[model samples]
Target: MSDGDEPAVTGEEVRNVADLARVDLNDEEVETFAEQFEAVLADFETLDEVPEIESEPDLVNVMRADEVEAGLTQEEALSNASETEDGYFKGPRVS
Candidate 1:
């Protein structure tokens, strides 16, 4: 989409975003960030118009050898617990 056709980012929009994110923003900060966000979105729009790239290597999941390793014993694991019952750490029960 052309830059002129793109929706303009405004302070009200920024404030709405901040409210949705549970953030507090003063009027001045909102105004400043609205301008910054508009610039960033314009840059992203420009990038979106570039030709599709295919030179990158295909993504592959890197794996490691599966092996069993020695680990902490049950007693050793529970040793630091403030409370334990029947070989397991005891915690407050949820209602």
Candidate 2:
């Protein structure tokens, strides 16, 4: 949508986005982001006017063959760990 047609983004909306993104933003930052968001929407409006190209390159999944190769031995793998438990690296529990 054009900037004129775009709905105003309030400080509450910016704050909500910060919360969802797991970031903290003060009131001034929220107001600044709201203004920046309006500018970004205006830039998007310009992009909407660009003509679509018919010969765009299609994206394809590129992968390599998966083959088994020699890897570290049990002793070598656990050698660098600060602690080991039953031939495995012992680390702090995630939970």
TM-score of each: 0.49, 0.48
- Candidate 1 lDDT by residue in tens digits, 5-92: 6447977899999999999999899988888898898799899899987797887878987899999999999989999999999999
Top lDDT model: 1
**Which regions of candidate 1 deviate over 4 angstroms?**
1-7, 56-95
Among all candidates shown, the one with the greatest TM-score? 1
| lDDT over C-alpha atoms for residue 52 of model 1 | 88
When summed lDDT is taken over every stretch of 10 residues in candidate 1, the lowest stretch is: 1-10
lDDT of each: 0.87, 0.86
Instruction: Count backbone overlaps in model 1.
Output: 0
Residue 8 of model 2 has an lDDT of 73
